[model samples]
Target chain A: MLLAIAQPLAWFLGFDSLMEFIAFVIAAAVAYQALKGYRLSKERTLLYLHFSFVLIGAGLLVDGLSSIVVLLSQFHRGFVVLYALGYTINFIAQLIAYGLLVFAYLQQTRNISAQFAATAVVSALFFERNAFAELILIFLLVYITAHTAMNYSVSKATNSMLVFGAFASLTIAHFFFLMFILVPIFFPLAHIAQLLGFLLLLGMLLRVNQPS
Target chain B: MIPGEPGSSTKPVSKYRSQFRIYVDVMQVIQREKNQAKPTRILYGANLSHDRLIKYLEELKSLGVIQESGTEDKVYSLTQKGIEFMNNFKKVESFASAFGFRI
Candidate 1:
């Protein structure tokens, strides 16, 4: 819902989709790894992580496909709806994905309860972007980033540092997205920041799976 | 035997560790002892009772990750598969720990 660019930029069309596609692959890989860990260790937190990344990958795939569709359609009036549909789906997916991540953190700290369940998803029609939604996402990312930061500080491990950087980058990307409403250039900047975030996450994954 | 927490030090002591965790802990003890450990070392290192350690050792042996030897003392060492499993487990543990989640 933080997406403010009703129409994606023409110049960055292919590149944006490519970046998102790559990010999608990385997200899916992370999810798969989390699932493997969950199966091996039966960790509930890993399960939550698996689902969160799954949703993130799904959202990225949908958005990337929609962007490709828009680019191929040449912004046809009829096809413009696809853009909205894609963004809306991606928005909802991210909302739930981040919410699940936040819930996972809360559960880790034993702060989660039934009361937070109902407030998890704020129902809204698709294609509706608002400050409120953006604020929620930023809030969630901040908490997750803080948690990762603490993790890095305690462990002083490169992988933890990467994860912390990735989340911090993502938070910045969302902030840029929120600003994109006023500054057109912020759209591309947001995408670049987001790609960097995912790339950092990919780095962590590679490190995690690297041969011992 | 003594079973500490799982994966990393950050995790609080839960009432029980999963079977998988116990297996990893036992293997870790073997690894820490330079890949050859006695039954008593495993029992003490993994924080398991004598009965539980015996049960898990049997299970690990059946799973092909560990093997027992020594006619008189019953020393244990990791098999090839067991070594690979431990390697993989270390990776998974680091990954989970990076996210502040214990596996």
Candidate 2:
């Protein structure tokens, strides 16, 4: 799987875990806002957004916690498997999360065929992720970013721009992650980009909640 | 029907306003008038049939979110509970709109 990059990032567990924890918080915040919106409006898209972020936040937490455990155990043999399990779970979570996002976007167009195609693609992605999870994430993020970009182009609102930036950052982060397979240095850069993506989402949430 | 809404297939349908949305629009008009609005102002602002406006107004009154006053000329205002609900609804609207989804 994409777990090959995890071995090198092990050396920087402290920083990596911290970045992930912060990203987790940001993801939860995004999920919370989506939930709040859903409750008020009963919007299915918002509900999808809520669940997707919840999955993302859960994945980050699990992965980060596993890393912390491995670090604390001084890389004991038994604790090491936890790292693999964490990576596997995180990979699967991201797979489903991004799938839901694509589903939400397709829902807007009300295309049943597209929805079925998405489900099939997501199923296909499961096997593909086992080979290169990062690439799959990159692929999904690219589609999401494209949708958000279209949203910004049409709405021309700063909030829409922020959403677009957030997804774009995530797409870049996944690209960096895919590159990490070739160069180890790309690992930290990937985390930085991922965190930037979440931070941009945080910025949007803050602006959205601000008194008008 | 608008996208994202339960059972809705398309976005905006700017011409279509949900009953709930109409309710919010009516309250907003009252709030915009400093918590006291005339029926004509509400009819124009919410773009509702006079019959629909009166029906919705009665509905709001029964729901305890809005109150009626100025019996001679007829005026409407939001109750404290209604004001709080509107405030929360505004947050929801803002959040949904941020993602370019209209609620």
Best TM-score goes to which candidate? 1
Worst 10 residues of 2 chain B by lDDT: B1-10
| Candidate 1's TM-score on the B chain | 0.85
The DockQ assigned to candidate 2 is 0.43
lDDT of 2 by residue, B1-103 (tens): 1112354455544466677777888999999999889999999998899999999999889889899988699999999889888877877776676666667
Tell me the tens digit of each residue's lDDT in model 1 across A77-113.
7777887788778877888888888877776676556
For candidate 2, give the docking quality class from DockQ.
acceptable
The lowest-lDDT stretch of 10 consecutive residues in candidate 2 chain A is A1-10
Where does candidate 1 clash, by residue pair? B1-B43, B1-B47, B1-B48, B2-B46, B2-B47, B2-B48, B3-B47
DockQ of each: 0.39, 0.43
Residues A115-163, model 2: lDDT tens digits: 5856665775558444366666778889889888988899888888998
Provide the lowest-lDDT 10-residue window in model 1 chain A: A1-10
TM-score of 2: 0.88
- Candidate 1 lDDT at B51 equals 95
DockQ of 1: 0.39
Model 1, B1-103: lDDT tens digits are 1122333324543544766788898999999999999999999999999999989999888888899888998989999998877877787798899898865
Cα error, residue A8 of model 1, in Å, equals 10
